[model samples]
Target: MGTADAFHSSRTHHAAQGAAISELVDRKFAGRTFGGSIRRRLQVRSHDGPSTDAGRKARQAILLVPEHEGEASSIMCGWLDASRRVAELRPFSSVRTSHKTRFGSEIDLPEAEYEAATEALRVYLSLQAFEITFEVPVEPSGRLPRPRRLSSAAEVPASAPEARASESWGLIVLAALVGFSVCYLLVLLGVIG
Candidate 1:
């Protein structure tokens, strides 16, 4: 195959393999992209053995591509799409937060929560042509919840009959090819005459 064709075929094969594995795990996979800029911050707090001490907070902002004007909507859409995927991957709880914007929207989330959500959004946005800034709080126990099973049907495996039929068809094709090759060899050797 040509280079492009080979690349396409390889991509398809990889996707199929991924789908097969995801199916076993009862998960669905989706991809997205963003185009603009992103900024993130993380905060952490340590409670001192029930003492009334306020938690620690850290703020960070990242500015990428200072010249991509008039692309905010595209960037927002990509971020939302990626956020949805993160929601799917960790289906246990909603990571919805309010953002505070001087003239736009307000997003408010805890440091760990925002980190998980923004990580997914960042991946999707990176697929597009935009800049990104990510600030994540370092929490040793912070992790996205495991993806839940969407339905009981998704948990079930294929039926035995279907699997048997597939195997039988494969064997039949192999036997037919082998038989045809043996006959062709005999004909070439004049043994069948």
Candidate 2:
């Protein structure tokens, strides 16, 4: 095969492998809760701004959390790819926490829960011929907080319902002010009371 043809074939194979891995991981842990203190977190997010903006990328991440209230322990894995022009993903829950800290408190997951997730992923990866294994420490050494970042004005869609609603209200207020001003000027000139 030509060099270019070989490269294309390899890329396609890798993409298919990645998709299979993602699907398997999500099915195993997407919504299951453990000991009422943990839940599987599989979040896929993307950003496709104006075509002129070449820095935009799509994101996919999976996190396993053992706690959500007070202190917490978690695991996270993610990757980025070129934009496919997809809709953005929003959080499944909108509930706010009482803590006002700048960062989350990280702690070790109970040995049982930690081992369960690690072993499951390791076995699946091997079965897929992906010679990879988790190298986690004896203790949970990473803090996997929910990712957050600010978006530029250009990144926010003007067609969003919230944005359109606020804009419509602003125009109505401006029209009201103009109408009131005209009435006041007419009264001053004795054109009308």
Top-TM-score candidate index: 2
Give the alpha carbon lDDT tens digit for every residue of 1-193 in model 1.
7974554454433233332332322221122222213432211111112211111111111111112345331111111111111111211122222122233463332345434544654554345422443223223344644554433422223254478789999999999999999999999999997
The TM-scores of all predictions, comma-separated, are 0.20, 0.34
Best by lDDT: 2
Report RMSD for candidate 1: 18.4
Off by more than 4 A, model 1: 12-70, 73-149, 156-193
List runs of model 2 lying over 4 Å from the truth.
1-13, 30-32, 41-62, 65-74, 77-104, 136-193
- Model 2 earns a TM-score of 0.34
Displacement of the residue 44 alpha carbon in candidate 1, Å = 34
**Model 2: how far is 191 from its true place, Å?**
99
Q: Per-model C-alpha lDDT, please?
A: 0.33, 0.42
lDDT tens per residue, model 2, 1-193: 9975564454443243334455665666666554334443443222222221332222334455443544453444323222221122212111111111223443233445544554555565446543332222222233544444423432445346578899999999999999999999999999996
